[model samples]
Every structure is written in C-alpha cells, then in structure tokens.
Target chain A: MNYEAIVIGSSAGGLSALKSIIYNLPGNFSTPIIITQHVSSLSESYMAVFLNQLSQLVIKEADAGEKIKPGHVYIAPPNFHLLIEEDFTLNLTVDEKVNYSRPSIDILFETAALAFKRKLIGIILTGANNDGSNGIKQIKHFGGHTIAQLPASAEVPIMPQSAIDTGCVDKILSLEEITGYIISICH
Target chain B: MHLPDQLNNIQNIELTHFFELIFNVYGYDFRNYNKAHVKRRILNRINNLGLKSISELQHKVLHEEGFFDLILRDLSINVTEMYREPGFYKSLRNEIIPILRTYPYIKVWHAGCATGEEVYSFAILLQEEGLYDRSQIYATDFNPIVLETAKKAIYPVSKIKEYTLNYQKSGGKNSFSDYYVARYESVIFNQSLKKNIVFAEHNLVTDGVFAEVNLIICRNVLIYFNKELQNKVTGLFTESLIKGGYLGLGSKENLMFTDVFDQYQVVDAKEKIYKKTIFSSK
Candidate 1:
C-alpha cells in the first residue's frame, strides 16, 4: 500500500534498532516519519539532534501547529503527546498520560490512524508493555498498514509480542529488515 | 452476604458494569482509567447514594437518566479550589502574565475545569493583571452537571475562608471577600468575574481541539487518566496551543515522558509551567 506518513513507536533498546532502520533511508526520502521514543520529560532535544547527525533526513522535535513536510523525521518531545492533524500539521497536547507514558505509542498510533486513515503505516518496536497493541488494532481498523519488530530480534519482546498476538500486524520483521519492508510497502 | 465482602464484590461488578455501560451507551471510554481509583469512586457513589449494594446503584443508574448525573459527579473529580497550590498561581501571575499581556486579544482554554472555581480564579488573576478586558476563557468539563454548577459560580460560604487564605498566599492584591458576597449559606462570586468565561461540556477523553489559544491550563486531571488517555489529551492540548503559547499542568504533572516534552521549556519548573518553544512550530 502507498503511504504518505510512517509512524514508529519504540521503548527500551530502541536507539540501536532505530539507527539501523533510519540509517538505511536516503536523505531525499519523501515520506513524513513520526516517532515516539520513551524519554524523560526533562530530557533535552538530544534525540532529534542525534538522529539528524546519524541520518540524512532532517530530524527535529515536533512543534505544535507545525506543518508536516516530506523527507523529515519528527520526534515526539519528552513528556507531551504528538498528534498529526488531517491537514498534515502537528498538534501537541498535555491531556493525560496514556499507558503510563506521556509520549505514548498508543496516542501517536491512534491519532495517526484517525487523521491519516489508509495513508498511514504504524510500526511497533521493542518495549516492555502492551502499549502498542490497541494502537495497532486501531490502525488496522482504519485500513492502514501495521508492522511489528520480530519479538526474537527486539531488545524487549513484550511490546512487539503483544502487537503480534493481536493478529493485526501485517509484517513482523527484524530490525535490519524493517527499512526495506517500509520502503517496499510505501512504494 | 456480609457487608464488606458484599460491597467489595458489588464494587467490582458495578464498576465493570458501569464501564461497559458508559462505553456502550455514550461511547465515552473509561475502560482504561486507573482501576483502583475508579473502584473507590464507584464504591463511594454507592455509599453516598445510600444504596445497599453496588448492583442496586447500578440499576438506578441504568434505569434513571438523571441518576447518571450524580454518578458522573461521583466518577469525575470536583475537588478543585480557586488558587490551588498558591505557588503555581503565584508563578502564573508573575511569569505568565507579562507574556499574555503582549497579545491584544487572548483565548484561554481551561480543560477539565471542575465546578469552575479555577476558571474564576484565572479570571480574577487576569483582572488583577489588567488582562481580563482582552481575554476570553473557555472553561470546559466532561461532566455537564458540574458545568452547570460552575456556571452558577456559587459555593458554600464555609469554603470561602480557606479560599481567601489561598488567594492571599497566591499574591492577591485585593481583599478576597471583595470578590464575592455572602447570601445565607452561599457565597455568590462577582458576576463580572465570569463575564468573559464560557462554561461548556468537553470531554478531554473524546473531544477535539478548541482552536488557537494563548494558554491552556489542565492541572491535576492527568493523574486520573491511564497512560494512553493521558497521551491522547496531551495531543489535544498540543494541537490547541498556538506557537510559543503557554501550557500549564498540575504541580505534580510534568511533560517528561511524553513525546511533546522537547517542544516546551519550563518557564517555572517548580510550578509545572512551560512555554512552547519556537522549534515546536516545526
């Protein structure tokens, strides 16, 4: 399926996995990528700066009301939620903590499912909790594609295992292979 | 059945039933709330309603329409005061006021405002800062009954003594008694305080954004939502805040773990007041 946006949710041991997936993408890659990585609220913008340094894509923390652009990666800032609007702009809210997380994977995936519909692709990666399972279900219900990191290959298997157990995931791939799979599906 | 065990069992059963009923009938998702708190509140409601069992209270709630209103009050928190955590209000007055003063017209969303006390407190603060003339406050709560109570702006005169102390602690420049008149057992707040305030029913759980705003105050509400709901509401706030706008949470609430933390900088870290960053607009 062709997709305009790609959303990824990750928790423990996500950095290396994310590095492998993102490093493979060319700087000119046109799809808008949004990610939620568990981090402390007091955390700085190091992740965005680090990702930008590692990958060719323009990486930055998502801002409220900022328009989404192609070939850039938007990371949810620590402690707040990042939602995509139908108009392809970013909205930030301080509503509540979901799944005991502020930048909850569920919030990112669920809102993306609502706003992007079939044009969205949701990826659930390593984590301890079943945070991404319900979100994956919502994306599938919205006719969007869903993928999970292979439990065996994930740093923490519970999150991916949970998503896989939901029987909604369209793909379960190793971290190294995820980028190619994403490219293939988006094309 | 023994009373304690019966109440315990009834609490569990009624809570599950209430969760299912609210989800099915109203489509307001409360399934993932903190289970312990939800159960306690449910049990409290049963006792407050003077029902023998949770099942009996459940029956009343299901059969009688207005009973749900009382049930909602039991479920939703309404323990807010005018200047809760006086230090936070102090920070708002000192730090946030100057920023708000820059704008000619300001729109503020008081999400999850329970019983309107905090909304009036904010209105009063705006008045003191001379910003009330240009500000419009949209005070919203999920509980309609509470919204009505908020609109009335009436409270027990007994609570005013405590609230007056809070007002003074929060740097109020005027007499707290000057803002309200005591009639019988009730204190009627000045009507002018609510002139620019609009009280409405808005469920942060299921509602959409309320457009551009200069500041969004959603204190003490996030502690009740499960992580997923918390994130959802946070997203709503993020969507509603204008670039460089201010977002304030309960003193205990911090943006540390959410995806939007990097989007703001703590204006007063101790008070949980944050200023939206320019980079947030990206």
Candidate 2:
C-alpha cells in the first residue's frame, strides 16, 4: 500500500505505547505520522520532547500551517483540535470539544481521511474513552485503512475495544506487532 | 480501502459552488476559508438538519428567509475564553505592556475579537498597569450576533472559575471576582471595563483598515484561513500597525513564513509576539 499519511489516536496509557511505536521507526520512514494523544488542555508538549529524545524520527508538537513531511512525527498540540487541510498543511482549532476531549482523535482521523483518502492509514491505540471510534468508522467509510491496537495487549483496553466494536477496523495487533506492521506496509 | 478518488473531488466542487453562492447573495466571503474546517462545519450542519448534500442546503439557503442566518452561525466557529493561552497574557504584561507605556495614548485593535473575552482581558491588564485611561480598544468581529453579545459583556457564571484561574496565571494584580457581577446563571462584566472598548462588525477578509493602532491582538483566528488568506490578512495587520507596534498571534501561529516576516522582529518566541520594525518594505 502506497500510504501518504498515518493518523493515530491514543489516550489514558498512550505515552508508553507511542514511545514503543515511534522509537522503532527509522529516520528514513516516508509516511508522515500524525498523532493525537489525549492530554489536559493546560498541558505542554513535554510528551513530544520526551518521545523525540527516544525516537529516530523527527518528532515535535504540530504547529498550525506547518506542512506534512516524511520522517516527521507530528503530535497534536494540547487544547486544540488538529486537522489536515486538503493541501497537506496542518490546522488547529478551538472549536467546542467533541466527546469532552479537545485534540479529539475523531477530528484528526476524519480530516485526514478526506485529505488522503485511500492512501491514508488510521490507527487507534490505548485510551479509556470512545473518542476514536467514530473516527475509525469515518476512515473506513472514506476508503482509508483502519487499525486498532489489540485490546488485551493495550494498557487501557477500553479505547481500542470501542474502536474494534465499531466493526470498521481492518487489523488488531499488539504494540510490537503493530510497529512491525507499520514498518512493513509503509515501505 | 477501495473508494474512488472522485468522491472527495465531487464534494469539493459542490462546496466551492456553495461558498460562491453565499458570497454573491449574502456578501459574507468564506470562499477563502480553510476547506477542511468549512467542510466539517457544513457537514455537521447537514447531519443535524437531515440534509443530503451541499446542493440541497444551497437550495434552502436561496429560498428560505432565516436559513442563511443559521448557516452563517454554523460557519462561524465561536470558541473563545478569557485569558486564552495565559502565557500570552503574561507576556503582554512583562514584555508588551512596558513598551505600550512609552506611548501617551495607546490604540489597540482586537481583530476577530469573537465574543470580546480577550478584549476585556486586555482592558483588565491595562487597568492593572495604570494605562486604562490612556487606552482605546477597537474590538471587531464579522458576526453581528457575536458583536451584540460582546456589547452585552455577559458570560456564563460557570466559566468564571476558569477565567479566574487564567487571570492568576497571567499575573493579574487584583481579585478576578472583583471584575464582574454574578447574577443567577451569568456574570456581567463591570460597566467601567467596557468604557474604553468599541465593539464593531468589521470583516477582516473584506473590511479595509479602520485604524492605525499601536497593538493588534488576533489570536486563534488565522488558523481558519488558508495560506493565501493568512498572508493577505497578515499584510493587512502590517499595514494597520504603527511602526514599532506589537502584533500578538496565537501561540501556534507565526509570521516566519509569511511575506511580512522581514518587517517584524521577534518579541517573545514562545508567545508568538512580534514587534514591527521601522522602515516598511511594502
């Protein structure tokens, strides 16, 4: 699959899960990875900083109007919903929170689906809320690939379980398997 | 994942036509707005109203008397709060306020000041710094309904606690509770705070320069515009600001890639504050 972009959603026990996945990816990875990990609206991008130190991929908090590029991991900034424009530039909004979460996983996945369509891959990771459930459905509806972390293997299985329950997910893999699969399919 | 690419392209064409119809009939120019944002809002409206497509919505917009007004509200993303990004306000106090004090009379244009929370926040900051009497704030938004709410200056009482916390974080001098009168379910800002503010309906996309002010605080508004519109609006800001005036953008927004990059020097990088340099290029 010639994927152009990958949209990820995580919450609850997401930091370690993200660290495991992002650290294994090589510096030359071509797919631009965009992630939304649920955090407090008042929090900073310390998570990005911490993950960047452990990852080969260039990782940073996404800035509005920044262009999507290969080998860069963009984490959605705290307190703002991150969106991908059709031109591949990022946009941030302070619109009313959906499912009580700003930087809502669904918002990112749905927008990316519209932008990249069949060339996109949507992944749902560890989370307690059902924020990414509808997003996975939207991605499937838009003809984008969908993957959910294996609920049993997740730190907090509720999020991935909800996403799987949507009946739209294509694959459910453990953290290690998921990382290997992404590297395999992306190349 | 086998859907044809034409699905999105068809929706895109319909959306462009819908925006053109809106501009030609109502004069609210959203043609330059970010496509994803506009589409999401329009799609949400469609889902709620049980409409099929943008074409169906367009037909109702043309014939229905009050339908367009609802669409206008749907298009306007009015998510705002007092002291949004408290660090920006803190920077305003430590970095920008001292410079503002150098001037005898300060003029501030709060462009895209939706609901005027930040405008009042600025007014409060000026008051604390003893510059309120010498300041004039022009608070402008394209939406008249929001402008009306700005004039009323009332917000839900539930939000006061959050505002108070932001005030403290922003280095507020006095008790935040002192600034407002709490009614049953709402808090009305003190009448005195609004004395220096002039709320008006001025569209940034269509409106011309109304004043050459010392400061312009337009936060979180430019993210809705595409790159071309963003550059054009930043140019408008550059032209409206006096030499050496300050322009505070949303924390994520910057002028580094814009055409006006060379015209301003960085004041505070973390807060996205920039000061216009003398000797304009354009």
Candidate 3:
C-alpha cells in the first residue's frame, strides 16, 4: 500500500529510540511523519531541533493550521493535543488531557486514522504508559498499518508491550528493523 | 470509489447535514469549525447517549427537550487555566504593557474567554503594573454557563499550585497567594481585581464587532475554527482595534496567511504578539 502519512507515539526512553530511527532515514524520505513524545506540560522542548540536526527530514514543532507535507517531521507541541483535519492540515487543542497527557498519543492516532484511513502508518515506540494502545487499535480498525517497537529491545518495554497486548500491531521490530521497514515501505 | 472511501463520503454528507440542522435550529454556527474537533466531540456525545451515528444524535437533538444544550456544552472548548503560557504573559508584561502605558485610558477585550481564568490572570497583571484603574477588560464567551463561572471568579483549590507556579514564571509582582482567598475547596479571587472587568456573552462566529479596543487577547480559541471562520473572526478583530493597538494570539496561531497579515507587525514572534500598524494599506 502507498501510505500518505505516518504517526508515531513514544515516551520514556523515546528520545534515543527516535534518534536511532530518524537518523537512519534517507535524505529523500518522502512520507510525512508526525510524532507525540510525552513531555512535561511546561517544557519548551528542543527535540525537533535535536532530531533535525542528525536526520535528513525537515523536523519542526507542528503548528496549528499547518498543511502536512512530504519529507518533513512534525512534533506535537507541549501541552496540546495534535489533531488531523479531513483536509490533512493540523489542529491543536487545549482540550482536557487524555490518559493524563496533554499531547496524548491516542488523540493524534485516532484523528489521523480517521483522516488518512488505509493510507496511514502508526508506530508505537518505547514508553512507560499505555497511552497509545487504544490509538493503535483505531489505526488497525481503519485498515492502516501498525508497528510497535519490540518490547525486549525497548528501553522501557511497557509501552510497546501494552500495544502488543491489543493484538492490533502488524509488526514488532527492533529499532534498526523498524527504520529499515519504514524506508522499504514508504516512497 | 472503494468501500471505505464511499462510506467516508456518506459520513461527510451526514456531518454537514447535522451542522446545518444545528445552525438553523439553535442559531449557533458551528458549520465552519474544524472537522476533526467537531467530529470527536459529536462522537463522544454519541457514545454517551448510546446512539449509533450523527443522524441518531440529530434526531434526539430535535425531539428531546434540552438535548441540544448538552451538545452545546460538549462543543464549547472550556478547558483553560491561569497563566497557561507563561512566556506569552511574560512578553505581554514586558512588551505590550509598556506601550499600553502611553495611552491615557486602555480597553482590552478577551474574546472567547472560556471560564475566565485567563481574564482574571490579565486583571492581576494589570493591577500589579498599577494600570488597573485606567484599564477596562471586557471578557466574553458564547457559553453563558462559563460566563457565570467567570463572574464568580472562583476556581478549584487543586489548580492553585500550578497557577501559582505559572504566575511566578510570568513575572508576577506579588505573591500569587495574595491574589485569592482559599475557602474550603475553592479559591475566590479578590473583588478588587474584578472591579474594572465586565463579563458578557459574545460569539466570535456569529456576533458582530464587540467594541473598539486598544488590545485584544483571543488565544487558543481560533484553533477550533476552520480557515474561513478564522479569517472572518480575524477581520472582525481588525475592524475593532485602533491603529497601533496590540493583538496577542495563542503561541501557534498567526495572521501569516490570513487576510489581515499585512496590517499588523510582529512584536514578539515567539510569544505571537502583533502590533497594529499606524498606516494600513487597506
């Protein structure tokens, strides 16, 4: 399938895992990748900039009303839920936190699943919580592809293990295998 | 089209019909709001009501007494906190207040002021700067329920700790504790802070221009709107502000692609502060 977008969720021990996958993507990587990494409500994160330096994708914080584009990475801004509109643009909300997370992975994944349907790819990486388990199910329900970082390879295995428990993820791969699979599937 | 694609088209038509039913019957224009946000909210209501689709919900809305009110409450974004973005408030104090000091009397409008926490936060900032007496704050929201809460100026005591931290980070002049009286489980703000403030009902989507003002703070509200609604409300703001006035938006929102972008100059890009130009090409 020709995927249009990829949504990623990560939390504890996510920074290094993200670096590993993002740093390996080619300069010509064309699929748009949107991510939500659990950060403190007050943190002014530089994760996007930090990742951009070592990666080929043009990485930046996702702003409200932004149009999704190829060859770019959009990180959810702190203390806001990142939603995808039907037109493939971005919408941010200060709506009540889900699973005690403002930039909750479930919100992003569920909205993106509705927006992109079968043309979407969802990944759940290392984290301490089960925030993205329901979201991964939504993606699978919509016939989208789903992947979870192998729990044994993750720094905090609970997150990936939780997603695995949902029986929705299509692949369970290590960091290196995940990066390779993304490049092989995405055009 | 494939089966899923065909289903999506049908769903879109149903949603559009639902929005029209709401607008015509209730006179609230959520027609041009963001689709994802609206859909999420409506789905939540559907699940709660044990209804299957927007069609079913619409039927209940038309037949059941007071069901629309529940939907209205669900649609209205009432989530807010004092000093939500400390950097924006800090910039307001250091950059915008200095300019407002030049005017003899100042008028500020908090458009879409949900539940009024930020409204009181602004009032406290003005008081600390010794500009409270000269300033008039008109805080408004379309939801009367939230407006009533705003008038009371009381909030859960559980939120006080976070608000206090936010206040200090926003360069508050006095102890954050000094601003409120904690009574049991709620904290009521000082009456002095509400003296120069007026709370009212104003709908950004349907209401006309509110008032001529020197500053307008409509933060985090426009993200709920679609492009057309955003531009329309922004035009209203442009018509309401005096030349050289200020406009503070949510950190992510901007006039960059809007119809009024050229009329305002960015004062603090990071904080999303814009100053209306003295000479507009329009």
- Choose the strongest candidate by DockQ: 3
* Number of the candidate with higher lDDT, 2 or 3: 3
Per-residue C-alpha lDDT of model 1 across residues A103-127, encoded as one tens digit per residue: 8888778767756777899999998
lDDT of 3 by residue, B1-282 (tens): 446557667778888999999899988999999899888888888888798678999998999999888888999999999998998999999999998999999999999898999999999999999999999999999999889999999999999999999999999989999999999999999999999999998999999986889999999998888889989999999988999989999988888878899999999998888988999653
Two-chain DockQ for model 2: 0.74
A1-187, model 2: which lDDT tens digit per residue? Answer: 7999999999999999999999888888879999999999888779889999998888989988889999899999999999999899898988999889999999999899888888899999998989999989988987889999999999999999999999999999999999899999999
Candidate 1 docks at the CAPRI level of incorrect
A143 Cα displacement, candidate 3 (Å): 0.9
Q: Which tens-of-lDDT digit does each residue in A1-187 have in candidate 3?
A: 8999999999999999999999999999999999999999988878888999998789999999899999999999999899998789988998999988989999999999889999999999999999999999989988999999999999999999999999999999999999999999985
Off by over 4 Å in 3: B1-7
Worst 10 residues of 2 chain B by lDDT: B1-10
Candidate models: Cα lDDT each: 0.82, 0.92, 0.92
- Give the residue spans of candidate 2 off by over 4 A: B1-4
State the DockQ of every prediction.
0.01, 0.74, 0.75
Ranking according to DockQ, highest score first: 3, 2, 1
Q: Is the docking of candidate 2 incorrect, acceptable, medium or high quality?
A: medium
DockQ of the two-chain complex in candidate 1: 0.01
In model 1, what lDDT does residue A135 have?
A: 84
Number of clashes recorded per candidate: 32, 0, 0
